[model samples]
Target: MSIWWSLHLRRDAASVPLARRFLLGAMETAGVDPEISFDLSVALSEACANAVEHGGDRRVQREQSVGRDPWDVWDEPAGTACGQYRVTAYLDGEKCRIEVADSGPGFPARRMLRTSAQQHDPQLYPSLSAEDGRGLCLIEQLADHVHFGNRPGRGALVSFDKVLKWRKGALLMVS
Candidate 1:
């Protein structure tokens, strides 16, 4: 699989929708069906929103866009926050890939979930203390994979994937 683009942006409300359309269109342009576009949109939107809220401040958010370096230049720019969030949108033959990263202080995926959360919750609960926890949880439920891991000195990556499934459902797609 080849990653076409990895976008890095600040933690701002203004950029949320722009980030959504970027992933949605990338999926279609890579041959993902329009029927599931909404799913991808919702998942990616929430991931990016989490990055913005927990990742860093305005100076860090607005200045950190466009990069190819995975580690070297990643944290040098935002020393205050110590880690940056990244959204990698790419495609393979059968699946569209999206990853939202926030390399801040965090535990690995195994530790983050408890026996209580391991159980299913249809409503996808969000915490009252913070407005953003639900988005990642929802992404996990909706996307094929949602990964969370610490990125060395940075933070974590919430990787999202939606594999293209053929026609048990294409009766639902129009174009």
Candidate 2:
């Protein structure tokens, strides 16, 4: 059986846990091993936090420059027009995939390419004292496969997947 879900969320702090909780619940209900579910949940939280912190400001500015109100462009309800991000999760058999995309300025192409090449060395990234450097590292360590890119002139995209191993003798359950 396959299970999937998608969320369009405002770029707010609360949305991080909301996304994490939803994913955790889905995995648990499907009888995914707890260890896999926990790791994915933490990785999901990091990705969502990155989107909230760094992914929507540039998009809002671009929209305003074009004389389109960001609130209207995003169809966001009043007082909640900060910006938007998308999270998608898919589970098929023992494989799981997740993608987080934002509408802000995408990552710099040169830097992204370089970072991808050096992901194994955490020293290539800013120190933890810096406010915004740890999420990518955490995601890299937790996910079995990771990809980073951009959406043309729009925003950044981070995707990762893991192949789960069920606990010994755990009955396979699908919802």
Candidate 3:
């Protein structure tokens, strides 16, 4: 059986857990192993958190370009009005894939290239000394495969997949 779902979410903190819960529900319904479900949920949360924190609004970007603080723009009540992101998940056969895309300014070309090259090099990323920068690396560690890229002027996209381990009575077991 094949299962897929997608969500369009406001760039708010609450959306992170909401997204994770959806994935967990889907995985549980499919009888996926709990350990695998947990790992994917953690990865999904990181991606959603990054989307909430960094997903930009064009208006907010413009404000920052002209010397206004980005945080100040977000501090306004309208911060989430134009900021949105998407999360999609697919489960087919033996693997499950999840994708998170945002309408914020995409990754810098240089950093994107560097990160793609060093995806497996944990040492290349800084220790979790700060709160904000560890999401991408954490996602990489959890998923069997990951891809990071941009949608031109649209935003950044982070996609990842893992080989699924079925529970004893999995409804979608391949074997």
Best by lDDT: 3
Q: Using alpha carbons, what is the TM-score of model 2?
A: 0.79
Among all candidates shown, the one with the greatest TM-score? 3
**What is the C-alpha lDDT profile of model 1 across 48-164, one tens digit per residue?**
777776665324443554553544445554433433456777665567678776645544455353234663765435656774456767777777766666666566677767776
lDDT of 2 by residue, 5-78 (tens): 88989889999999999998888777789999999999999999999998776523343445546434334322
Q: Rank the candidates by lDDT, best first.
A: 3, 2, 1
Query: In candidate 1, where is summed lDDT lowest over 10 consecutive residues?
Result: 166-175
Evaluation by lDDT, superior candidate among 1 and 3: 3
Per-residue lDDT of model 3, residues 1-175, tens digit only: 8899988888899999999999999999999999999999999999998888877654534443365553333333332324778899999999999999876777767554334567667677867686567887788889888888887666778999999999987999887
Hey, what RMSD does candidate 1 come out at? 6.2
- Using TM-score as the measure, name the better of candidate 1 and candidate 3: 3
Q: TM-score for each prediction? A: 0.68, 0.79, 0.81
- Residue pair clashes in candidate 3: 56-104
Clashes of each: 6, 0, 1
Kindly give the stretch of ten consecutive residues in candidate 3 with the minimal lDDT sum. 72-81
Whole-model lDDT per candidate: 0.63, 0.78, 0.80
lDDT at 168, model 2: 54
Q: Could you tell me how far off, in angstroms, the CA of residue 100 lies in candidate 1 after the best superposition?
A: 1.4
